[model samples]
Target: MSQSKSLLANIGVQVVIAMIIGTAVGAFMGHSAAMFAPLGAIFINLIKMLVIPLVAVALISGAAGLGNSTNAGKVGFSTLAYFALTSALAVALALIMGEIFKPGVGIDVSSVEGMFSGEYASKGELPSFWATVTGMIPTNVFASLTNANILQILVFCLFFGLALSKQPKKNREPILQGVNTIVDAMVWMINCVMKIAPIGVFGLMAEAVGTFGFSALMVVFKLFLVFIAAILVFGFVIYPLLVQLFTKTSAKSFLVAMKKPQAVALSTASSMATLPVTMNTVENELGVRNATASFVLPLGATINMSGNAIYYGLVAVFFAQLFNIDLSMGAYVAIILTSTLGAVGQAGVPGPSFLVVAVLLAAGIPIEGLPLLFALDRIFDMIRTALNITGDAACAVIIDNIAIEASDLTESEVKQS
Candidate 1:
């Protein structure tokens, strides 16, 4: 009981620290903000340095661990459905917020158009929707590794897992169990790495506060407000509804379980880095089965970025308005759809929403509007990561409830039958 209380206290501390840090960064002396910004960068880099190998190994082994083909499909479909629904909701919320606020109505359009740089070219690098779908299959495993290609890695894992599922039991069963053990061990190792989180979080906060003072925020205040509001709605309102509708479990219980991990996510500002805590919260606290938590949390960490989707959609609209580009209803729909895809596509990158903004601009929306946004991205990222963590926990609760209720109902019917 003491340990549980201590854990809860730590979570409260984390959230308070994140807010204090973000506010300080937004309001402090400019030179100080600049001096400390490197600390945050170093902290972000440490987690990112570990992401590629961690994701590749965890995902591949996650796939191979699915001993049965049927179980794999059930897990896969559930995970994807959650990602799709949450992402769509994120996009819708962003669009609605952007239109209502008109954040760019009085901004200097020249700041965007005049300062446009060639670096933005990479924004157009992604293929069309169909192209991304078709390209999911990895052509060269080593090449994908060298390039740190997440989609390719995801593709490889799925196929390899499917093959493992099909192998004769004598050949596959032991391998599946062994792979599962190894993957779990890898995740454990990552948790050991997370022991450094407080130091890293402090560094990240100090630097961010020292570098971006509050005066600079005036340019993007409306955008920041929109994002915060959307995150609140999704985190507090939408997630609860989904949990109640799908799981028949207590949403209150789910939120209670999520407290610690959500705090960690806010401080760290990286969902992937927060996975160990998230998994523990879902399985140990929320009472999700290990198999479901393991399968769902990691995948959600990587791809179910509701916060990123919201930012992408809103930023696209903000840039369009700043450029005096009137978006037709059709254009707005495309923005929502494309940004949803982009959120998943660009997951795990630093300032990924910037890339999404550039992508939208290439379609003629105005990429130049991003500089004003760049000033506030770090601040927004903190909130976005918190929302992302919340969404993942909500999905876990809903899925767990679904699986459990199904089991209970089946048992009851069987008893009667």
Candidate 2:
């Protein structure tokens, strides 16, 4: 309880300080005041650099262990289902909040002239849904590794791992055991790498607060509030309810287990950085089975971006409103669809939300509106990371209920404790 309170208080203080600093710079010094942006950028880059290798090695090791075709298929389906449900819910929440708040109604588009000049050429309509599916099968596993396309790499790893497992027991047992040993060592190394994350997070936060200042924050104040609210409600309330409804776990115990990791994720603002803590918490504290945590937490860290999905949808509409673009109902639907996918595609990067904002602008809305929001990105990113991890835990609990042999405590004990 003390730890939980401390974590919450720490996150609150950091957010408040960041907001005050951001508002002051944006309103006072203006956009040219980019003195601190590099600090945050460097911090974000370091975390991202670790993500590809972490995902590749971890997924390969985990999948390789689950050699049975049926079990592998079940894991794959469950993972995809969780991702789809969370992403869709995020989009829906954004749409609902956007309508209720109408955050962009009175904003002046011209005041921020020359804000964003469409500098980065659009990546074009994210290859259709089919493209995402087809592209998963890498032409060459080595090529996928070189390209660092996580989805393709995951595909290659899954098949490769299963093939090794399918080999005759006499031939495969020793190899599988040896691979597990290597995996254990690599995971330990990854955990060691994460010890420095707090420094990276502090630098990123300091730099972001330094550059953006507070003035730009006021520009999209309403939208920012709505986005944060949506993330909290969905990640904390809606997800817990679902977990309790489906799993024999109480939300309180699960949430208690998540407290430390949540703090790490919030401070670092990188789900990947928090994965080790998340995995440990779920397996040890929450008593989720190793198979469930290994499969769910890692994948959730990479692909199941509930908070980003919400942010993307809300920001797209908010940008449209700020620019006086006036999105039709159809456009809103398209935003829901594209933003969900965009969030996943950009997950491998450090600042994918900002990058995807460019994608949204090219799709039709005003890119200039992004500058105002970008100022608040770091602050929002922290909250979004917290929410992301929460979603990951919730998914783990649900899957554990479905797959784990037995849990340490009953749902009632989970609540009472």
Note each model's CA RMSD in angstroms.
3.7, 6.1
Tens digits of per-residue lDDT for model 2 on 311-372? 87887777776666767777776777776676666552345366455447544776645566
lDDT of each model, Cα atoms only? Answer: 0.71, 0.69
Model 1 residue-pair collision total: 9
How many clashes in each structure?
A: 9, 8
The digit string of per-residue lDDT tens for model 1 on 1-417 reads: 998778645744655565576546535554554555565566566666666666665565556655353345665777788888789889888889898988778987555466455566555555767897877777898888788777777778667766776788899878767776776776676665565565566666666655666666777778778778888888888897788777756778777777778777777777877777787778777777765665667678868889888888878877787778888887877777776666676654445365575448544675645566666677788778888878888887776666666567767888999
Sequence-dependent TM-score of model 2: 0.80
Off by over 4 Å in 2: 1-53, 69-71, 323-327, 352-364, 405-417
How big is the positional error of residue 361 in model 1, measured in Å on the Cα after superposition?
3.6
